[model samples]
Target: MTAVVDSAKRHTLQALLSLPSGIVRRLAGRPVEIEGNILDPEMQLVLTLRKIEGAAIEERPIPGGRRALVDAAKAVGGDLPIGAVTDLDIDGPGGPLRLRFYTPRNLAAVSPALFFIHGGGFIYGDLESHDAMCRFLAERAGVRVVAVNYRLAPESPFPAAVDDVEAAYSFVTANATGLGIDPDRIAVGGDSAGGNLAAVLAQRATRAQVGAPPVFQLLIYPAVDFAVKRPSRTTFATGFFLNKRFTDLTEASYPPAGVDLTDPLLSPIYGDLTGLPPTYVVTAGFDPLRDEGDDYAEKLRQAGVAVQHVREPGLIHSFANMVGVGRSGPEAMGRAAAALRRAVSTP
Candidate 1:
């Protein structure tokens, strides 16, 4: 890794360690208040607190309040050489969606393509926030990467983002010839809420009978369900980077009101996983959503979908995003990139 990246990782880890444990714990176990104004005073306070913490951690806000906290993570090791970046905007269900394409310099043609979705729950995050990581993946996996800028919540709502994702996928598949990509070598992947969307998209594509389904899915500490409770929800719900309070706030920001939490489209863990693509699920040891990710993977397995689950010990939720900060951050990304490469290389 580059010296700059090494510094970033160190900075990120220090900031995370400095977070008030009590506040993290309280934030984790906080319950969602689905009544009255969506932006209730308490909700606003929680948002404010989150912003404060984010600022302390050097988090950068994307178009929405969706912030990517790893941008400022001090790199702790040598930087890995990367490649070229090209930006484009594709038509979506609502309008046009922004996309960033990354290709390493020495990569070969007919390489696998990874459609990346960034995590910020459903509220914040964009292509810029995850720029380095996407480039890292393209370089490390020796594949092309297309990172989607899906719509955010509180405005776009549940299905809106999902619709945009599907539209983006369709556009990519339909225009694969022009893009010089192999339609049969496509995979979808994401972290946190993005992971949830990746899972949902696999199901959506299979059900809709769209072009060939994605060959594999890479889910990193994904938030898969909003209805059924998991053990992590209680054990690691409080103190950590992602807390219960933030989850509730983000959930509120998405649906606003009157949306069924159990809707398969909303909470994909409750959705049918049958006939979906093969999957690789990554979970954090101390994350509240760990069990949900595990459960979702198991559901896919039981439904006959090929699946593999990897649990990172001593890691917390959202750690992968900290690639610019903690030692484990880039390590996780490297592992994920290798996994994607293996998935794409397999016949």
Candidate 2:
């Protein structure tokens, strides 16, 4: 019975995502309006379907949560075509880390690269989970994407992922010539927890001089500050996909004992923002982390950094992952890719 129900729900998910937005809106009924933003009708339908599916990843243990995320990504993430993919293992701060590279067609002699980090609240995400997003961006934006598989939390704890990302960036930069990449045009970007790492890396390039500095950063619905519970956390706390309970679980699972929640390394918004590269911050109106992303972009602006903040007023968190889904998610990610292409291509 459980297997049947799961299969039925997966089929329904595919069908619902295939429907026209007009039909999805009609089926979803009145718009979900809060804090002056109407949730996208497609996203609203998705939330309704999820409610029926029941038992979010947060309700389960670690392995279950990881499975849920990967399964969800597979369910909605269509196989986006890319020119090629290569995998290699490199020495990280702790041990060997696997890195995936997405190379698009129409190759340049020396292309810019994006050091992408996956977002699973620092616990569950990996190369398989975000493969579609990386493929889409690589093909559309015409950049080689170096997706990092940093060590996860509880086992590796806070600074381990941080150290691994720093090490990965340094390794890439040091080997740019051999890799056929232009070291100066590398950008650091990620979604959610990955976004936090990308922001921290961007800051560290100038502050600590970690490696060759990123030319730009694309922070998609990043959790910038852990110390504050902003109104968005309350407004869209429940009924939305990323509920407060799930976020709380992730918070508890990621940081180890005695780590300060407000440390700049943990929360890059608290760090010095000046001298960072050009930044493109993407936030979703219905997301719990929206306010913090806003504040981070604002802080970068105030610090005299070049920042472009774009809020998809109708989408939810992780909307960028739905590359094969309904209208809104793909459109929003298209804009993000265009921004990234422009940012990295500037002479």
Candidate 3:
């Protein structure tokens, strides 16, 4: 019964997103004010469909909500064909972590690789949820994409995710030859909480003076400062998909009680930004985390780190997952991947 309902919802979203771009854009643009900020047409349409299809997962039980969110993302993003996709398990900080490799057909001998982490506010995503995005990056940038399935919150809290990121990166760099990747050209990236992990990992590697740190970091609307509040949080507090309630739930699960949210591992914005690799930060106008992402980018620039920041003024959180919704999703992802390719391919 549950599977049938999910299938129906998936088809509904897929059908809606298959409409012509202009029609989708026009439908999305119809004026409807919510929470002070006029929601982006694309986001508004997505959210409305979510409401009707019972696709909003934040309010559901964690296990079920995670599945629903993953399904919805996969449905909207639509899978892409890759040269080859392989799944393997590698040793991580806590235990074993699943890793998926998306290699373009006709992969090069020593291709650059992006270590991707999927976003779900720390609790609700997995590799399958981000398969489309990874394939897009792999195909567009002409790089192998290594997607990590790190441990989640409540079960694996705080430093667990960070540790898994480091472990996965270490495995990739150490075994680059076997994986057919360029060790020195590896990069790290993710959206939302996954971005937070990538950012924190870069800082940790820099501080530790790792001989071969990630060549680049791509953060998409990252949750940078878990401890502090920004204007965007209040301004876009209620209506945005990443609202206070959803964030609060995810935050609590990861930190638990008595844990300080300001810990550098928890909030990478407070960590040392110097000596990190070149970074490309993407921010969405309607996201509550926008200010923190912008602030972090500025700090990286001020610290003499190379930073390319792009803010999509008419987009909302998780816009990247709306690939079939319109051109914005693919365009944003394509631009980010192009920058990533340049950064990683640099001599």
Return the top candidate by TM-score.
Answer: 2
Better model by TM-score, 1 or 2?
2
Candidate 2 per-residue C-alpha lDDT over 1-347 given as tens digits, one digit per residue, 9 for 90 to 100:
65464456556766886787688889888988987888888888878777776598888888888888887876566767888899989988788988899999997878998999999888888999999999988888899999999999767788888999999888898998688788878999999999999988888987757987788999999988877889999988988888899788777877776778889889999999988888999999999999999999999999999998999999998798888667788889999999899998954
Model 1 CA lDDT for position 125: 70
TM-scores across all candidates? 0.79, 0.95, 0.92
Error of 2 at 318 (Å): 1.1
Top lDDT hit: 2
Q: Kindly indicate the candidate among 1 and 3 with the higher TM-score.
A: 3
* Whole-structure CA lDDT of model 3: 0.83
lDDT tens per residue, model 1, 255-323? 657878888778888888888887889887767898899888888899999898887755667666554
Residue 310 displacement (Å), model 2: 0.7
* Shift of residue 338 alpha carbon in model 3, Å: 1.2
- The lDDT values for all models are 0.71, 0.87, 0.83
Residue-level lDDT for 76 in candidate 2: 62
